[model samples]
Target: MMPLDNRRLLRSIVKLTEKPDVRAFELALLATLTEIVSAKTIRLCKIHESAKPPSQKVVVDVRVSDEEPLGDDASLPTLLIDDAAFLECLAKEEKVVASIGLGPGVRIVHPVKAESKMVGFLVIECEADIPRDQELVSIMLGFYKNYVSLLTHTQRDKLTGLLNGTTFDDKLLKIITAQRVGKMRASDGKGLYYLAMLDIDHFKAVNDKFGHLYGDEVLLLFGRVMVDTFRDSDLLFRVGGEEFVVVLRDVDLAQAVAILDRFRLAIERYPFPQIGKLTTSIGATIISGEDLPASIIDRADKALYYGKNNGRNQLWIYENLIAEGKLKVAKDDSSVELF
Candidate 1:
């Protein structure tokens, strides 16, 4: 293959940096690199979280033509992660890190660092050894790192590194809205939906017991558990301290109850450290056409209050209260529960 024309490559790199997204930048760079150097595949791995002492590992994004599947290791070859020798060479060699004749093909691993930090890695695979002189590769990678950082911020919770509360809220709304719109024609039911609010049984206990640092850990861990337990379509939100909300779209009372039961059981089974065995009180409501988000939330809150007053670690549906006359027919100060 003809050597990559350095001047033209620089111009192309400038154009590629104009892409607005990390994936787009990766694809463009991979394509450009393939055209210039005749490489088989290009992968960009970006690592977001690392273990203590900083692993400096990155997870790659792969883009390839119809050659091979880019394979499993394309994104991030862990040989790059735990391998101190390979990394040291890349940092000091000022030359391409290559593996020739020993593997399926030549593996050229290049580190993409920004602001003196190893932000990600770019791996180029080809049939032969690749030379260094990576000015275009460096330029393209700089843009990619910035773009990935932005994408990470947009997708992650600023406090907990989970999906942001707003992002979850949006997703919940979408799923609920779709279910409501689609269920209009279902045979078993129409216009039935569910939503629930969850509040830590006594999150204040954590703050008092272990201080706010541990309290923060509890909240973060709580968010992680919620995300893990719920369906990807189910919306989970940390709307406030010790409070979360989930929308159960296209669900009847039984289904909604079952879903909440599962989450409640999961929480009850999982013992939280420092906080000990923790439980949550959940209030859920089925939505009607007359219901707005605020009203739906109010119903859930009422159910939550019922659970807290009667007992914690249980799912309380609004209909049960209405049937038992525990809740007022209309808003009035005089009808409030004495308990």
Candidate 2:
């Protein structure tokens, strides 16, 4: 095969950078790779190193085929970190091409690293190898890694590294809009989105007693706990101060409550340095079809406030509060900005 024109390759790189979100970026990368290598299949697998036991490895975050549309599920195949071939690539910090029994063609797996950390991998399966394919893939992935770093820096909180307050509004809006358009429907006959707000109980007292530095440590540790407790698909945000928000997708009230309660218990059990015990108050509400971003946040915030005022270290559901006449439903007014 002849070499790809340098001008055309530069144009494709520019186009890939145009994608605003990680999902779009993955799809764009797959398309570009398919064209460059004439690949039969391409997939972007996100490595979940934090998952337990055999599952502590890679999951197919997105798969784009010349044969079919992108798949939604991540369960297509789970790549173990302990696998010899995978470990070889990781240890060497380089791309490794190998043959698998699942298909006839050779597969090239390129590690996608950001800030010197392995975030994911790009796998391409093709029958014929183009000249300088590895070099081209490395160049393209470099652009991807840089763009992702920039995007993450802008969207994340400087202190906690969770999604910041500015990004929360847009994320919440997108989730609500997806639900309305039937793009994000729940499978279990439950609500499509669950918005929850969490606050550290007696946070001000912590700063007063333990000094600001120790207080910051508490917040940092809390954020790490949240990351470990929640699924990767769930959007976790540190909107401000000791407060955080989680937007859970496709889960019922029971499931959502259970998840939040589990986190709360974990927080309680964790021993913060110098601090004997710490607890969090949580309030959550289902994202309704007619609800706007601000409205959903307001509901969750109200529930969180209820938990804080009534008893520290407890969880409250907004719908239950409304049914019990403990909280009043706010009229949905699109013009209002609750944040």
Candidate 3:
């Protein structure tokens, strides 16, 4: 590999911090890493945890070569983190270099830590070790850690730690774009995205009866339940007071409905200290290929209204309601200005 210019590398590092969002920052980091190390393949794998019945273990979320084009034929490499070498690297929480296959190459795994917590690992494949590669990688990882901290603070809600409302537009738009371009797909080969609106039932009564402080506690506890109930890959946002949104990637109507119902049941059964038990209402819709963010959200919001109006503590699917003539189809108007 040709030597990387120090001046050029510094410029790339500066650009990393200037990225508009986390996704952009991640892509920039991968591009810079490829240029710096002349790597064949690089992957960032994050640990996603689910704490529901059947007690699942750490599920790996992998992002590979984001710079590559996404077409009908484009497919990201499937990641298998169950391998012995990968498990050992994760256990040690340190750099691990190993030869995995018959090919004349080596794989390097470096633990990625943020805010004193081990969040994920970076894996790179290269033909041979470059001089001072570990040092360079460490410095790059440090920049990532700092940038991620800042991004997290800005994008997440202070009370709930879920994504703030301001970040929802960008994330939903990006997800829609990825789906349109065939960059993301479910295991079933159907590239589907489901948007759902969730709101705590009779939340105003809770606030009135127990006071604002107790209401806040309910919100906090509910957020924790969401984290445990939803998959790590699903995008979750606290968009408004006692209201949340989740975008289910790669899941059809049945799967999405099942997941939302599970969350509702969990909330109903949960004991909230003095509050005893509480319930939630949900409205969901499958995102169509040409649907705009606002339109998709409007549909879900309508469905949520249907659930709340008919009865509290229920889940309603917009298409299902439409099929039954209970709800009319929402007009698709992307030209309207959204503020």
Ten contiguous residues minimizing lDDT sum, candidate 3: 65-74
Give the alpha-carbon lDDT of every model.
0.65, 0.77, 0.76
Ranking by lDDT: 2, 3, 1
In the range 1-339, model 2's lDDT, one tens digit per residue, is 446898989889889878876667778887888788667777777666443553365455565221122245654446665456566667777888888667777877788887669777787777755557767888888988888888778788988888899888877776666566664445565645788999999999999998999999999999999988987557789999899998876678888888999999999999999997999999998886577777788788888888887878999988888788787654763322222
**Please, what are the lDDT tens digits per residue for candidate 3 over residues 1-339?**
667787988888888878877667877887788777767888776655344322134534344322222233322322334455556666787888889588898888888877676666788888866657767887899888888888888889899988989898777776677657764554563546788999999999999999999999999999899999886557789998999998876667778888899999999999998999999999998776467887899888888988898888999988788788886543664222111
Q: Which pairs of residues clash in candidate 1, taking residues 3 or more apart in a chain or in different chains?
A: 44-60, 44-61, 45-59, 45-60, 46-59
* lDDT string, candidate 1, 191-296, tens digits: 2556788888878987997899988887887777776676533546677678887776556678788888898888888878866788889999875544455667
Query: Where does candidate 3 stray beyond 4 Å?
Result: 49-81, 128-131, 179-190, 329-339
Each prediction's TM-score versus the true structure:
0.53, 0.87, 0.84
* RMSD to truth, every model: 9.3, 4.3, 4.8
lDDT measured at residue 329 in model 3 versus the true structure, 0 to 100: 46
